[model samples]
Target: MATTEQGNGLAPRGTKEKLTGDRKRSDPEMNGGVPGEKPVDKYGFTGGAQQHCGESAEEIPIEVLRQREAKWLEMLNSWDKWMAKKHKKMKERCQKGVPPSLRGRAWLYLTGGKVRREQNQGKFQELDNQPGDPKWVDIIERDLHRQFPFHEMFAARGGHGQQDLLRVLKAYTLHRPEEGYCQAQAPIAAVLLMHMPAEDAFWVLVQICEKYLPGYYSAGLEAIQLDGEILYALLRRVSPVAHRHLKKHKLEPILYMTEWFMCAFSRTLPWASVLRVWDMFLCEGVKIIFRVGLVLLKSMLGSQEKLKACQGLYETMELLRAIRPQYMEEAFLVEEIIELMVSEKDIEKEHHAQLRHWKETHGDLHCKSPPRVHGAKAIMAAEPPSRQDLRQRPTFIVESPLAPQTDRVRAEASKENGKSKAEQQKTIKPPQETANPYFPPGDPSPFLNHMTVKASKESLSSAEHDTYL
Candidate 1:
């Protein structure tokens, strides 16, 4: 019997003939692979494609993907109309998430990145061609690979991703020489590039630094510190247990929260959560950051398991750094953050209060004073806000049968007390040192002092009335 060659070019039977024909090629890689092209996995997606933490590309269904793409295109076509009239619907969709295929375009629309790109045409190239501030250039180069090292786009040294990141950073240094560049900006820029092209990414970064979070990346980082104080106040009200634990352990918000706020949680959170946060941050403003921070703190320290696991300051810090993936489930996390009820109004009110306190202590100082470091002290021993201050602002209403005394009654009581105005003022001490180490040291203004006194009197009266009841 004659020997024959197999289809794959192997000789058949017991024949010792050397098979000499070009080996049959394997099936072309899926997703339109070309011969000799970069190797791709079984799925058609390329190596450069981003893989969200805890999620695989292959798991997504093709039909669902098509629908997402279609929905995105429809939204893009009518973006102006959607923004003007269907903003609620648009916000709802964004909250759900911008589909991966359309995320870049959606972000562009959300941030008005396209308009900024058009306005600054050729500007990035011009800046890139110039020698950036040598200091920032070196820093930007160092950070390029540090960002998204696992992702193919940024994994390679001096690759297109890095080059784009460098150009964007260098352009920013030139764009705002005073601010120069900050390390936190690298991740923010890198995340933007992952979703959009470099120019568009740069513009989006411009919107973020300039519009969304003004004064955030500047030399002083005053806004960030101020926001940290604001977050502390919110946390105290939202989750007192967690707040007390952090204070007891001396885990100042600055120790952990600086990077969280500075990078907009890009470095702290899982990629999926980060993208979802960015979606809301783009839509809702910086308030989302505060809300997210509160949720993470409450989830991490609110429970016994997490608290026990984090016994010391170092352990607590580590726990915060390696946030459990379970807490980062985007839908659940976003919903929890939304339910936090930390409105911008609340944040603004706290900001003004903090600012007033800051000014009273350090008279029109441009630079923020360093936060005081306190040793172990009774958590309750921290000075409370003056009673008079509380009376002036009845935002926190205590339900009691005793109605607030009338102005006439208050005046008569003051007269009967026979205390001079100065003596009466002396009765109300200044706002005491805050238990929160993050709170800047300050004395309450005279007006705040008066409010504190009134608040104390009202509280005492309410207590006596309750006892009578």
Candidate 2:
């Protein structure tokens, strides 16, 4: 399979021959006769004196072929190692932050998502499966449409958002039944679909819920609760004042913060920040999340000074999503903010140690669970709360125990007549004093449980709240 150009270049290495359009190889010196030299043909491949293929051409030398083969083998060997090194470097670069143009492809590579695969091709082509359970297809279909209602483009591309979402969710429901499709998967899948094809989106979703953000989307949401509890601890350590403010105001982290743990900063932050977080998230593992939560809480401390200027959980989560410090800078900025706001938030250091421990132990157990077959179903029975587990519930250092002691139902009845001042009065109450104090004051209280909060100007109003539910 030697090409003509390579053959020409390899032959007659010592002689200078310029090739003409017809693949003729000629040497000018061969044409000219020197004083003692025998006259030769102009072409480098001369058979007889002064003849260029006049009758029979001379046989090519075996040594020439051997030399050419040696050179080719050498080049192949070098190229193989070069490609290997290149691939390794590219993997490193992807984990840092995929360059803009290569992001889509690199994301596929980094997360092990195959855009076109034989097994999944038919699945992608087929229409979503209709199942008997109001359990599986019904729930998947509902979220498929609901995932990105805010995006007009998604709405327009019925195939892109609604259809793809349904396909992936349904297929996954069939693919991994133990941990059936969950609520957070919709938004996470929506974000991936924005940057990737549907198939890649499906696998990326797999890596996320199953590998990356484990336990959170599981049967009990125990992992999600654990992460939030960890976040609260970090916030308290790094931004004690903000933690105090949020609690003094009777704010529960999950009510506002669940989106952060669920989507990993997707809806809360700017797109760029979300990607940066994802970069570290996938590389550094789940521990990066706690550090990030600490970093975000610290950032908000600076904004807390203005009267009634406090932010809700969603806005706070969004701010974390908005800021995208470079890899080198994120560590310092996180530390600086934590130090600035907390004076004592050692959560990052503790997390760093925990990460070291995690690395030393069996690799992230979160991602290595046995795959199950419960599409859109809980993976396992809920773990019952035991005495040992109950004893470990987080205790506030200066504050009362974690979990509020009273339900807001009694407070709501008392405030029905005094709806206007109920929230302000609630904030002033000694019992509620044990709760967070900067709580917003308004009618139709936003706080629904004992962990009640007042509606902020930016939060959902009564009409909007009704619509949202």
Candidate 3:
């Protein structure tokens, strides 16, 4: 798959392009020279040849993989049965890693994407058919090429990868106009496109933004800005040394971690580690992201000698921006995260405390902003994406904690009295945590139970808003 032209050089006029089009400055000489030969990275990505880890996943014996995939297929076939009887086993397997062959199907099941898709048939196609908002469309088009240029799927401009990526982003804006389109979504959609088709990818992205990480891509990014506080709080307990260094340097979590969490670390970790982190993230929740960030911090600044290198905010920021090779190694990083003691309960507790602090400092978020939609399908259930359309679709109800439907109802009921309703609307509480089909009890994923937040104007900072990776 080696393109003739590479290294920012122009191709000879007669040298035909092997890729979908002529190579851009970002495109490089693909690792494998022979046509159709496997790229040095089994994932079909280039430019990571220098960063190859100690143990290659490709080295896993084919027989072992086939057996693993078989086991996964069996569990998938009887998913609910497995969840009821042996949920712990499934959760552990996810931590180890979903087989690459079954990653897409696994992700669909893990994120409840399959159920979501089934409930709302042809919804993606319908939204994709309609023209997207002009504001989002122009921005989406500009950011498409910046995602995973080293990966074959998005290597070419206007190629199916880029095309599919565009559809997914545009559809989300249409699906949840309140959230609009956030720049952090580009790399995330690109990663999803690599594994699943556009339709499935779109739904997974929905689950990620809405369910897994609520209010992340929403207007003021209140969810993530708040999580930044939560992460630092947990860091104090998990790694006191690292936390002290960050506090001394005044290196706010938002300064470096914004892009990391906003995109679910798709832009932060090595591709292999990114997939593994996602596998767990899908099963557990945002706590997986918190744990990963904590592990990186502990590794970078756990020791006095490590702190010696980071004297000021700039040095500490640089160290975080470019993580060392040892930390980036997939197996090592996942192992460290697993070994780390931080749990969903810990994250949940910190989130609740931070919520109280934010309200005191920022005032009532809802007071300033218009009536904002808390989550997607809750409203969609009450009203379809396009209720007035002639076509009919099933009522896609989401029993998600992120969507406070009952609160919305009570708010509406109070609307008959204007002044009283305004007082009542000071806060719209998030719903309580329900038993997740993906992670049953004893496993513990701390989402939906508390920490109500108000969304708003200072949405994403310039760095966060402009983050293309």
lDDT of each: 0.62, 0.44, 0.66
Residue range 1-469, candidate 3, lDDT tens digits: 1112222121222222221123334234332122233354556575443324457743667667667766876676566556557777887888888877567767776676666787787899999999999988887776676666666566666777788899999999999887777777777887777776688789889877767777766655567667888999998998999999988888777776776787777767777788899888887667778889989989999889999988998888778877897787788988987888887678777877987898898865442222222222222333342212212121222234454557655575567455565666665455333332223464322211221222211111111111111
- What would the per-residue lDDT of candidate 1 be over residues 337-402, giving only the tens digit for each residue? 778888767887898898887688655646433322110011001322222211212212333336
Candidate 3 has an lDDT of 0.66
| Top of the candidates by TM-score | 3
Off by over 4 Å in 1: 1-61, 304-306, 365-469
Q: Determine which window of 10 residues in candidate 2 has minimal summed lDDT.
A: 373-382
TM-score per candidate, in order? Answer: 0.65, 0.46, 0.71
Show the lowest summed lDDT stretch of 10 residues, model 1: 460-469
- Residue 113 of model 2 has an lDDT of 41
The per-candidate count of clashes, in order, stands at: 11, 21, 1
What tens digits encode model 2's per-residue C-alpha lDDT throughout 1-469?
1112222111111112221112332342222212234333322211222123233222335455444333322322232232234544432432444433233333443343432232254664453454523476766664454444434224333444566667777767766667666666767776666555566667667756665565566554445544455567667656678777666655555544555667666655534445556654543345555655666565554345721444564454344333443322433533443234321124445434544554566354443343321111111111222222112111121123444434554475576656667666766533221221112343332222222222211112221111101
